[model samples]
Target: MTVTPDIVLVLCVLLVVIILFIIDRVRVDVVGIIVMVGLPLLGLVTPQQAVSGLSSNAVVSIIAVIIIGAGLDRTGVMNRLARLILRFAGKRESRITAMVSGTVAVISGFMQNIGAAALFMPAARRIASQTGIPVAHILLPMAYCAIIGGTLTLVGSSPLILLNDLLVVQGKSYEHFGMFSMTPIGIMLIIAALIYFYLLGKKILPGCKQIRERGPLSPLLDKTYHEVGKIYEMVIPENGFTKKSLGQLRIRANYACTVLAAYNHVTHKRIVAPLSEDELSPGDCLAVVGPPMFVEKLARDFGWIYKDELKVFADDLAPANAGIMEGIVTPRSALIGKRVGDFQFRRKYGVSPLAIFMGHEITVSDLSVQTVSEGNALLLHGKWSAFHRLKDQNDLVFTEPIRGEEIREDKATAALTCLAISLFMILVLNIQLSIALFFGALCMVLSGVLSIDEAYLSVDWMTVFLLAGLIPLGLAFENTGAAKLIADSLMHMLGVPSPIVLLASIALLTSFFTLFTSNVGATVLLVPLSMNLALSCGCDPRAAAMTVALAASNTFVLPTHQVNALIMRPAGLRPIDYLKAGAGMTIIFLIVLVAGMRIFF
Candidate 1:
């Protein structure tokens, strides 16, 4: 039989989506928009039909959730929580891993997983530096916990939103999922994950030995620039420096470093305004910034011994060790199209490229071998000595130094306020209003809880636009009648009289597609087909639709399926890590989903 024009059009569109996803050529959102508009031009869908998916409740809910997440990130509340957790973690690696992962999972249950991960990352890095623990030991668990936590709530992740929309469209009218619908399963998964980490996470993860040997600040300490500048951490020893008048020492002329700030060690209040010459005292911490040479000379002249061995300035010095250098592959970064092994990074820059924050998640086994795309954040590592030299080179864009205090302080009240707004929108108002979530996020910015620039920085606009663009394409599948055709074929092949078998088939296929393509895209494509299949089998279409929708989000086998993959790279992970950790979870989720659909739907 000759295939219809609609089938041919859908096949072509599917091919494009798959190819674009694999090649990382255009942004996925752009690709999605093209398919949505292009299919209509080909007479496969009407303009109205193509635009309908944009109105999907799922899409609206997701946008709101993202905005709400941005608000929480702005408040710096999460950072405070991380610090408190780290303080209580002690020195036991396994206990630390459990605590960090557990806390991340719990918080992510109510907020966005990526938001939680971003908030916790700096603290994790700090703990790693202070305790001489390799970041690898904690980061993977951190990412995994976020993923598991997101599975708990309807507002936690996009897949849950998609599932609810699919059910509504199928006439089941499942407006909301219970807060704890997935908690039992999620909690079980966490317990299992903790056990696995205890058994194998330590052995496979990198150790703290390298960090200890290098010293806490060794990576950032510019050994080559002897005395060019001095970063002194003077406790108000005898209050002499504090008591000395600014004019007496001529700090600006003598130190050559700007007096960045002064904090009264006793009061902990920062002295931002100009200090009166007579206000000098003995008990304050002087945060001075100036030429290394001048500071070094002054320190010697003043009997200030350089205590490089002390951890007093540990927080301030940690970023230097974890050098943040931004480099565009000028079609020649010694990294383009090369794997990690090819460059032998430790021998070259004395650091590893931790994470590549990109506009899209694409695979690259070797950094040197993979073709570099524009706008990718290559998180590089190196000794401060080598990084300074690298920073001077024209090939890489060196990021401005980020203050440790700014990062730590950024984690305050925003998360709580955002949560309050989200809860009000979902539970109290009962309006199903996504704009409320956005408004709540906006409140954070308007109230000075978070600065405008900081709020903007917190958003993953690429992902947002990608979703916006892809939603339209779902219409093409429906308008073209391609969905009906696929549904017929599926029913003929596997649609037995039993609804359970049919649901399983749809769920399994949806899960497979999700592993490779965007989960939202996977859902938009499969939901219509599964709905039709359910009708053909004389079963509730909502159940089948829910199966497909839920399955799309359960990508635990590979990093490619979810945002968790992007977070994994900085933790120094390999593909096998997902294969081991995510595989069992994927299986458990599938079992639970299938059973839940049978009983609930």
Candidate 2:
């Protein structure tokens, strides 16, 4: 093969892109955009070709897949799956780890692996709290399995979904892969991972101490707000404060007491974070958190019956349903410079402000009147559902991971039907993958499973644009004969190795590329090269191209992968920890990948 000026320029651009990716200063998506614009500037690809990736089949399919996943999430399908896993997981650490990790692995075969890992993270933490296992032991295994599980189906990972497109662009006689073409090898890899973790986890996994079984966030809440106040229940007498709304009494303003929940004994009604206009009728029970002296004074002055224990409000105000949480006001929050009372925080957000930790000061009184600022940590008490809603908003961010019943359980069946329709179209009807998935996503929006805004919010636009921008780079590799140049160089170095050796080498190279750069970048850069290499060595080009696609998901030795980074902060994991576990997993991944390719393909 002859190396030309176009090939040299393409290689130079590729080198710069890889260096920029490794430097980690600029965002990966920005690097992708650089590739998108840089190639056209260099005249390596035409303007039309440069922008072709934005409308490509792979990018469209990924968008649809994300929306479909969100629809299922909104309808509580993942939550139900988590519950089913817990029902059978038992109390053993190894069993729980295997069950959760395996289930996530299988789920990742259909949707984005990072999404699958995130969906199961809270469940893994819940299991760790219940089973006396350190979350460190469970999270890494789950993350690892999720990465491996992406190999199960074509649409499972970005790389695999982009494979057919790259192959066709190679303009070879290669056939496109079916959705489940890689399932046999993927199943083998998943089983191998489960067995490896179950057998050697205690020896190799991190040994971080377990948090309190009550839930990790509980202790943090107690330590931070222990000085704020104590929870007390009070009952209203027959004629005490009759027909007077809570606003008229001005309890928070005068007494520094916040009513968290109200239970009416006569109507058997429970209102959490009751509005200011809610009337204080006789025989109503109030769940309030305040200073003991202030609470006693209110009881004495108003002739209200006081109780040392929460009897009627116990279930309503239980830790599982309602508790104190720390919420940090985002820098771009709408609430900035405004008082908490300006937005009617209690009525709108369904959370009561207990104390504001601003700078070094902790303000407990007149919380509604206190001005809000960026990064102000507000200690709030409310139902988990309220915190969950706040998480969706950008103004206030919760510090702790919350488990709440926020899913629309009523739309679950509709979501499932939509998913079934998508699958049927793909497997039976033989429709285009992107078209089938998009139709399913449209069904989700039309069926009231998810609002249009929610569907749009579900997409990680960065990933979409990254894939879109990098596609043209792969086209340049093929169009400029850069792929052929590199393939000939590699073939000369290897001195005509066997077909299996060729496939293994391609897998190893792709695995290394994905660790420093992104899996998507690695796939786009290598698929064309792999096809050329296979042809040069008299090997099966399809197998070689597939090798590059599958190996892209084998990045576990670093925290560079999205799933690894997602779990790192929560698990208190460091680089050395990933190296410890990922080394063995990486070796196993290669072994299974090579052997499975030889046997299956």
Candidate 3:
């Protein structure tokens, strides 16, 4: 098989994209845009096909799914589910690990994995703190569970959606797997992960001594108060700032305090990360953090009650309740390149930036002056419920546990019902998945589960655009014989004797490679090639495609994955830590993948 010039150019672009992703020098979406624009210019794919993925039903469905996830988040349904699951974890560290692993996995199948993990992280931390489980032991397993949980349904993961879409593009829509088609194998993989982590995998985990974490963010408390800053809270009287927006008050500038969350004395509810659009009502108790003197002065001037200890800031703690936690800034963090005071951290994110962690240096007390940079972790304080505001944010990930009732069952029921209707349409009515998802998103808004603006904000435009951009590369591969070339390369590397062996081999390869690059990128690059491999080998394309899709989520081995990175700083992880536990888990999962394929496929 001759490799055409088009194939060579496509392969070169693919290599460049992979390298850029691994190096962390450029953003993933930017890298994808390069491929989207480059492929057509290089004449690898026609201009029409290059932009086709942007309007594809697959991309549209994913956008709808993201909005639905947001509705679940705003409604607090997922959080309630997480808290309920946490009840079964028990006091034993091993039981806690098993339950957390399985719980997040199961819930993740229904919601976005990141959102599921976000709600559960606080619970997991609280469990670890109370039960004496090592934070390291719980965090990695939780992250892994989130990834595998998405495998249970086609809607559960991006790779699954992309694979099905690819099948449609290839005129194999009839053979596309159903919503629950991946459930059997997904359950098997999760069971294997939990069992391994519960028994044999426990030995590889760092002990409480090594992690030195009594609470997820406890180790950072000293730096928070003495180094970063201390926690503070203020109450807003109906007459003081009534009906005023956070933007109008200029409280952060006026009193030098970042407003974290507002507890309504009348409503008995705490609004976390209240948006600027939100008006300050009478009886609103705002949690703020600033210098002791400044906080006191602000309290006096506004005729508001100020609790320097942050007790009243906590929703559960009541008129006198408050608390503190840690939040890590990522590469593209909105909080970066600005001092905690200047940016009005608490006003913006609904939490005070108490301190910043830069490499080996920890700055706590003087955080207001120091500019935050990428990779810096900010320690914050406020109500546990207020922490939820931070969860919906994209730039930073919080480490502190959010205690008590997570999901608001009343509102959540509406979102869940909408999701059920969408799933019913896809599985029972055989409606186009994209159409069902779109209708579900609409229902969420109409039911008041989320406002239209909230729905728009909830979508991860980066993921949507990334999918749109990189998907055309798959078309290029198929068109230029690049897919066949890749298939031939793999066939030569591992001779195709039994189709099962070929399937397992492809799955194994995808699993290993996903540890290095974004799972979505890996999936987009390889799934088309896997389909071609199946056709060339006279094997089942559906089975081959499903294997590759599931395998793309095998992102347990490294912190390169977003879920892993989110937990790493909080867990105090090292590279070898991932290797010690992940290797065993990976090997066990490979066995399960092979067995599941042989039995189910």
Candidate 4:
């Protein structure tokens, strides 16, 4: 009858979490928040520990990661990269499937799998759209590929990396995994996944009734076009745009309008999503997008081509409206043969081209010499007003309204630059992961690829809250002896006199626990028990410890595992699908793990 106060608190928290997860009524973030704040209120952890997740370095890095991802996507960096890799995929469906999985795995092997997925998922979707390949066939494989990739290096997966550090802290340094020690097994799993997906998964990938044609971005871009900003074709007379570098103009800074592109007869140059260094010139015809007020002020200040408020069209000229519009540059149009830089398009026309499809390829690096091709497609970006104005002109072809056209060549450069610097710090300088990401995000914002406000908004608050709220519960479990209790119960029930069984049991249990919680959390709770079990069973504690670390990644089923969840919905897969697809991979991984142990130990 004399239950410890700690037990009551721990048990109460567990019961509450299970109930909340089952009901699924309250949001997951809310559930985490309750556990975070409730534990301390019930006298389990200190108030500091309860709110610790909010201040954790991991939380900040995660936020930075999301912002970094947004910068990459918004700037078309990922798109450009995806296009390059996908080009080699070939036309064969099987080849495409194999190539996509292989590329994602290689990228994921070096970076966080989630970030790698974010970079390539769109390309997979785009490939599906362009080639008539089923998205369902590729999305799930993409997720699995990334998961498998993480097993390759020391830092590939957090749990694996963190497990070593945790062991060192516990004074079990002798029994640790080296940086590339995981390569053998990790490669085995990755190869197995690739082969399986190509031979079996690709062939059987469902028609997925859930796949929306063109994937999620097209429709999102469609809806967001009219929902975000006003696009205007504003003229920039001598004083307004001439002689100031777009960076100096700080149009986005001072005027809040992006100079999508520009052309001027004065310079015979055109600017396409010109970087900050590209300057403006007199008589520049600029295309810009901004708030209605900024657009109007800009026009009044410059006296460029602008809509007369009284003489409007079908859609309102109010700045509140936003959408994607396209226009063709005609031979008669003054913009013809102009260097993009001459007009400060953003400063004049008030719109930018998302893509410039032409018969001849214009290397992006050759932007300086690139002229406006006479018969090319200019995927213009800006307000509905800009499109309307472009339409009335004698020179260009205007296409139907489109959405999601905010790609920037300059921003893409910024993303690449940021990623490059971060990678250097991480791989060359050996900087901590969180610090590397934080610094990279700062560089992204400062470089003008990602603005501060955009970075803040880019964060997925739900995931943040969930991370912040649930992290402290790990402390509660340890403090309350729940970890010990579980270890003892397992030892008595399944911990036979044999070391091999003990090792297998520990590894299996750790993998099972990761299905629901994070591998990091699972590792933290299981490390103590696993280490104790190893010693008591007379097992090589190092072998047993590493087994647990490897098992943490065996989080095969359950969308609850974020890695599995990454492409879950987009892949049009349900929980049952994950169980079916992942089970094979999990079994393959564990089998290799055991074999590797026997062979290496």
lDDT of 2 by residue, 1-601 (tens): 8888998998888778656654657665677688889899999999998888788776787677668877776676765554466568656788888988888999899876765776677556645644567888989999999999999999889899888888753454568899899999999999999999988998788877765334213677767766656778889888746668888988887787888888877888878889888888888888888878888888888888877566565545645456778889998998899997786768777887788888988888678788999999888888777788877788888888775546587898998899889878975787876888899999999999988998898777776666677778777877887665664576578767788788878888888767644577678788877787778778888898889999998988766576776676567776567878998999999999999999998
lDDT against the true structure, each candidate: 0.57, 0.78, 0.69, 0.65
TM-score of each candidate structure, all chains considered together: 0.55, 0.58, 0.52, 0.63
lDDT of 1 by residue, 174-240 (tens): 4445656655555655676677678877564544354653422223433422222433454446633
lDDT per residue (tens digit) for residues 297-369 in model 3: 8788768877654434322323212356667787777778787778765565555554567787766445567
Which candidate number has the best TM-score?
Answer: 4
Candidate 1 weakest lDDT stretch, 10 residues = 216-225
Name the best candidate (by lDDT). Answer: 2
Native-structure RMSD, model 4: 14.5
lDDT for residue 313 in candidate 3, whole number 0-100: 37
TM-score, structure 1 vs. true? 0.55
User: Which candidate model has the greater TM-score, 1 or 2?
Assistant: 2
Off by over 4 Å in 4: 1-26, 91-98, 121-140, 162-177, 195-207, 210-402, 495-500, 515-532, 535-538, 559-588
> Which stretches of model 2 miss by more than 4 angstroms?
90-97, 107-147, 150-185, 195-322, 325-382, 386-406, 496-503, 509-587, 596-601
